[model samples]
Target: MKNTIAERILDFLKGFPPFDSLTHEQLLIISKQVKVSYFEKDSVVFGQQEALHDCFYVVKDGAIGIYRDHTLVDQCDEGDIFGLRAIIRKDQYLLNAIATEESIVYGIPAKLIEEVLNTNIKANRFIIASFATNTRNPYSDEDKGTLFANETVLQPNASSFTEVQSASFSKNPITCIPNTTIQDASLIMSSSKVGSIIIAEDNKPLGIITDKDLRNKIATGKHQITEHVEAIMSTPVITFPDTITVAEAQIAMLKHEISHLCITKDGTIHSELVGILSEHDIIVIHGNNPSVLIKEVKRASSAEQLKQIREKAQGLLQNYIEQHIPITFISNIISAINDAITKRCITLSIEELKQEPPTSFAWLAIGSQGRKEQLLLTDQDNALVYENVTDDTNTKSYFLKLSEAVNHKLSIVGFELCPAKMMASNPKWCLSVSEWKSQFKTWITHPDTDKIMLCTIFFDYDHVYGNHDLVDEMSDSIFDAIDSYEIFLNFLGKNALTNPPPLSFFRNFLVEDSGDHKDQFDIKARAMMPLVDAARLLILSHEIKDINNTIARYNKLSELEPQNSDLYNSCIQAFRILLRFRTQHGIKNNTSGRYIDIDSLSKSDRLKLKGCFKPIKDIQELVRVRFMLSQMM
Candidate 1:
């Protein structure tokens, strides 16, 4: 029988992949033969161009730095597989690996790994993923497709990676003579259905006439119809080279305060104009401009159009994430777009009803939208706050009809009906302002599971489409109620600490043990939601409002609590890494980023994840002491 250490190694190896497909007995046999090696900090494991070792390594402890031509390429730590590139390619080592810290590693014979792979299909896939991950382009790809490939696994999660690329612009541009009349330019624009006409001389763009130019310059009597194109055109057109990315194009438009960019062969007007890229062209190709999408939402009469637009927004989200754009900025942009769509839905619903709203009412985007941290399409959590009425039944009936239309429109626009029916259309949610304040008071005074659930969902409310005063009044009442009952914060803090971060008893990963999720890590409950929930609870305790995003809340906390600034700052850093990790994992596996298959991750990734647990551990300890909740559990 293999010793306990070998069996333990085999068990871990079996869960992770290429080894998972091997027979238990065979793996056990091989594990026993594995040689354990130790290296001091900065000690060279192998040098570039060195002949390959007989064995490749699995990191047991600490980190190893991989360098190509003396430039660091990657860091490998626990559970990481390294030195196998040489074995795989059957070439000399192309990178030098040195210990980043005192480290222990298990050296498995190259022959054994090959033997394991000979029969295991799953193991073979794992090997392919490992190679693909390490060699994937750093500039072009973000490790989005290297994890898993099953359709069932890929659909539920939303990611801020793996975006649909912007459509390539046409290179051959049509130009016009610089001295053409406004009349001729109008004819050209009519024939083209394009909003702008680029005026050029000798194939070089000189100026541009857009619909705006025609309206403001010609129609408004700033210039005559018989005038030269230059008289009615905006001079010195914005220009970019053919190599501009979709993102760069968008930025250029915003930066230079111009709509049409003359695509010049050399990116300067002195060069020949190859093509003209209009703002409308960008809107059609990219589908993400907030203003353009809002207009599309307004015109969309069908559900499918809204769905396609929403799906395109997901791609935009992925790009924002990859660019390392601030999550707050992403959330604001997405929420503004989402809010516009919702407002348009309300308008459509009112039109469908053939009756205006009977009284002033506010549509509240409760939960994540209220806190403004909504990054994924989870569900529609909302409510309604209406002006008080003498006849409750008549008011209720009027608003319920309006809400039903609004809710239906929202579903058509890609917001799935809230599973718990926590929606405006539900009578229980559509309440007068006084009633909502009473509800808040009750939840605060009598805290229980149901009350907690209600508080958790409702307290993070943002005014979606409503009377501003009603929302402000609601907010005032809520803070007043909380001020009267300070223990509400304690209750919230207790709830935050409920699901302690899932570090195992021995400080290893506590993976899901059975069922469909067996051998996978619960990233949501174990990692993400804990941080999110903790941030919400912490922010609420401080009586802060409208900061729902996890990382942003931590950043605010860092500023507010300067003495514990390091802790809050670490939380922010940890949350960013976790968010990025989840996004990359979700994009790769096409899953909801809630669970992670441990075997699919390389040893280095596992170590990086393990590093994230440090913040989770420290923060949870802080929560315990601050809340003084030793007796709660």
Candidate 2:
């Protein structure tokens, strides 16, 4: 006789993880030994310090809350495994597992799992990875995802790996008046080849009808075929703006457990319907690759065209951030797009000049843009360095004219000119190589507050276009000057410690007391800049000129100082979190994302920001002791 219960369990197990890694016959055999248990909400499945059970548990239904000292750390939904970490190590449970909702759990016997782990290499790696994650960081477990694989890309709920852009939806949404018969709506859906149709009044969505509604209402005879759509439709249809992201649309669908989202002008039903976002639309996105955008930028005939491509890159970035792509990967992609745009701007400006330069020159992007960590469109900060010329007058004039044209084009393409006049067009900034070296000497040796600030901004110079040799010489000059006056590094370190991660005495975020963003948190100056400054100062001390990105600098620092690796690694995480926050806030508020409203932040965001404060505090302390800033203080 077939064990019907075992077969049912086998079917469910085959759809999910490690069990899925095992052969069908092996899974069926294991399923026969599975012990199903039920628990009530608020009841403990396993208590902290309890001896390990004969089997570890998998969540079959509802939610299980993992807690340490009664503080909820993680919530495991259906198909999530718990209690395995302790069982793998043959230790007592370190964290309590309690049911958050009435739950059904399956207990897979430890001996059987061990037998599978011993026999199947594929299943062994899969199960061991989950075990490794749980042992390393119980709080994260990398969320029990596969090592080095992008889960977001693999899942149907999100788009492809590189497809981090705004979601594309059908602008010509199929629709009908609310009073239209269900039969008419069905016919409209069929003719339109759409699964859903909006019930609208004057272009505003009142409700929606999908094929599922037709099957459940009409096929089940729950509602008559001639009844009005309002009687069979899903009322208060979910909505988003046309700018919704692929991941966001996927999440909304998953969260609401619906197939369609009504896209509105202002992202609400009260506004005019602009389009409809269906799951099919996101699943079919071929992905917006950065290389494609770069090729388009290279071919762009006008700054306006480049600007449009750049805006598309912003959508890509939004999707990346939403999908939790590695910050370093996102940085590389965005920087490439930005670099391509900058190169195109220069090319157009050069063509407009209709004359070649007097000598070899290098365009330098200073500060954030130079660092290649710029994720959002911001004001341009740049300079120019040309080889020493006997004809000083024409050389300076030619480069200045070129710079002016380039700056204007960049501005038109959405990079606003620096309000501080820190651009290549400025005569002070567009200097010969010798002049640039002299300028670096002046800033480094003088060591005044203003000079130090300028040094901080200009020291991270990167060759954006033209001669690389000129930029290399500039780097040599800065390092040579730093070697002569080591105190400058101390001063730089002192500057790095200026803002200590914006926290009040009571552990609340320190907010702006005045100005336009009164009561808002300055995420850039308070959180991001501290890490950026620390990385720069540390890298300069090591004479590492090539690495400018904060994340990359921290990675290098980790390699250089293994004892301090933990601190540097933490700084990388903190900086990435803060940078992502700034980008998100900027996109949402249409500002630079420097100042964020504390009231608007979710509890998770507030905690993430708070987590960054620790590394900021530690790095500052390291700077103080290493530089002896304590005496200066």
Candidate 3:
């Protein structure tokens, strides 16, 4: 069966996420099984509450308008996937899928999706994250102690283990040309507030002169102050690359009996001087315990300095995981370090802008960082919300420039730019308070697959900096929209069930079949997110706000539903175990803690993970029954 349509569908599917995570052979299978369908302009593909289509759809041409009731929720054009949440839940379509113009779509079978989910960890994760964003509900009423549960309950561990944390150095080193006079060099150092200056010729480090050189060589009349710096400088300077660690820095300084080390583009002395690491910097590294690291982050003058401190923090993280510290405690510490770095970057960016903001704004950390569940360094996901202004144009330009500066600095500090460009720097994500409210309202009221994806990301935002009132207002606006559109939670509830229990019908662990993590389990998608999504749906139903962490949300759920206390407790325990397990895997593999190699686990560990799946199944059943999801099915 040679099918050109399937080939076209495969070509289109390969370009999108979840699908892109699948294999060529797998996609070929899916594409061949796909049912091609067409719709005329303004024709309904599927109506709200219609029986679930056996397959989900991918738009091939024109656009599909997903609607809840009469309101258009989201518009999907080429390569966008829709109708999947319903098929996954085995439920009726929550929203109508209508063609905005003449269109072609490929309906992928639920069976194929199940096969892909079971065999592809990346695809599975993409599906789960797509469906279940912002599933943790923060507790309402500002009980600061409960709001940040770990800060209130967990005691900070005194770091007994000190590894070779990398040394932080100033990258924008002071420099002078070889012909520059000694007095001019001293003036350059004075103005730049550096203790040493490198003398370079053609961007290559030739020599170095320090305050000591002025004191020992020139001040003692070894050379005239007005002489060229090359006359007084130390030739054949010691150099190390930026990757040099604290121990290496210390040994280098001691071995050479030098007070400064030139950080060159390459490790060789012939390379260009990019930075100067001095005895003072080495001393700072020794002082950088976790608390000292926090202090350093606060006082960090540049993104590169913060990047070095963050690297040290990663060492701290590795040590903590090896020591088997509580996952909650580790997350709190890492999150605090991350937040401090973000705040510092924001502060530095503001200073760079050289102008006060036109209005109050709140910078938000969304997704994993918002839930404070980030264990490894991941891409930055953030948004900006400013107060309403008479003329939004100037205000938006100011904040956009501010965000551009902030996002750039964050990238420099090792928080990679988000691949999807969901950063505050993006014009779509940077909005005024009213505009944000409207944006949320549209998503909530319309409630489509695309809108749901946005909801998952935007809903879990935690304020990183700026005005608290703006964040609070945004929160209030979200609840208000959800209140008016109460059925939206049901749609979210169905979405939460998108990634069903991770176990196969035979009770074997479901692992990916191909790609980077072939044969590895995705603990994040299969085990963790089910609980996270359940918590958010349950909490939002109660209109509770502010509790973003999954464990904390479950704890609250236990109190809110005494009948379901045992289930919630089970979930809490499972979540904690899963979190620790993922953190350990991340440290072991030096990755983002998403995939798990099943063969690497012991028999007992395998059973423990399998046990976690039971609760996921149970909670999803609870959501189905609670929301009467079976009616849709």
Q: Pick the candidate with the highest lDDT.
A: 2
Compared with the true structure, the alpha-carbon lDDT of candidate 2 equals: 0.81
* Predicted structure 1, TM vs. truth: 0.57
Best prediction by TM-score? 2
Root-mean-square deviation of every model: 28.8, 18.5, 29.6
lDDT of 3 by residue, 1-633 (tens): 778877877888898776776788988988888888989999998997588778888888998877666644456778778887666645456578899899998888878877887788767655553332101111213222221213442112221111224557888888879989999899999988888899887778889998767877987988998889889889889888887665466555544656788888888977777888986665444343454567668768999989998998888777666655566777777888899999999999999999989888999999888999987887899999999999999999999999999999999988899999999999999999999999999999999989998888788889999998999898899899998998888889888998889999999888888998899898888889889899888988878888888888889989999999999999988998898888778778788889988888999999988888889999999999999888765
TM accuracy, model 2: 0.61
- Poorest 10 consecutive residues of model 3 by lDDT? 132-141
All models: lDDT? 0.72, 0.81, 0.80
Enumerate residue pairs that collide in model 3. Answer: 73-446, 133-456, 135-536, 137-547, 138-545, 138-546, 138-547, 139-547
lDDT of 2 by residue, 1-633 (tens): 999999999999887777777898999989999999999999999997687799988889998877766645556777877887666555566578999899999999988867987898766655543332222221234322322223342221222222245677898999999889988889999988888899999999999988768877899999997999999889899999886765466556644657789999999899999999875565333224454456568768898988888887887788777767777677767887888888888888889899988799999889998888788889999999999989999999999999999999889889999999999999999999999999999899889889989988998777889999999998999999999998899888888888876787899888888989899888888888888898999999999988888888999999999999999999988888888878878878777889887888789988988988999889988888998998887
lDDT of 1 by residue, 1-633 (tens): 538889878877776445656787888888988988999998999987588789898888898877655544566767778887567645456578999799998899988767766666556545553332222221123233222221112211222112223324656555578788899889988887777788888888888887767867777887888888978777888888876555456555644656668888899989988887765455344335443355556666765666776776777777666656555556666777788777877777778878877789999888766766666766788889899988889888888988888778778766888889999999999999899889888888888978987887787788888798988887777778888988777787777777777777887788888999897898767876667777877887777776666777888988898998898888777776776677667656656576898888899989888877778878878877888777675
- Tell me the TM-score of model 3: 0.57
Clashing pairs in 1: 16-599, 18-123, 79-603, 80-603, 80-604, 154-590, 157-592, 160-318
Segments in model 1 whose C-alpha atoms lie over 4 Å from true places: 1-287, 322-324, 514-516, 588-591
In model 3, how large is the Cα lDDT of residue 210?
A: 84
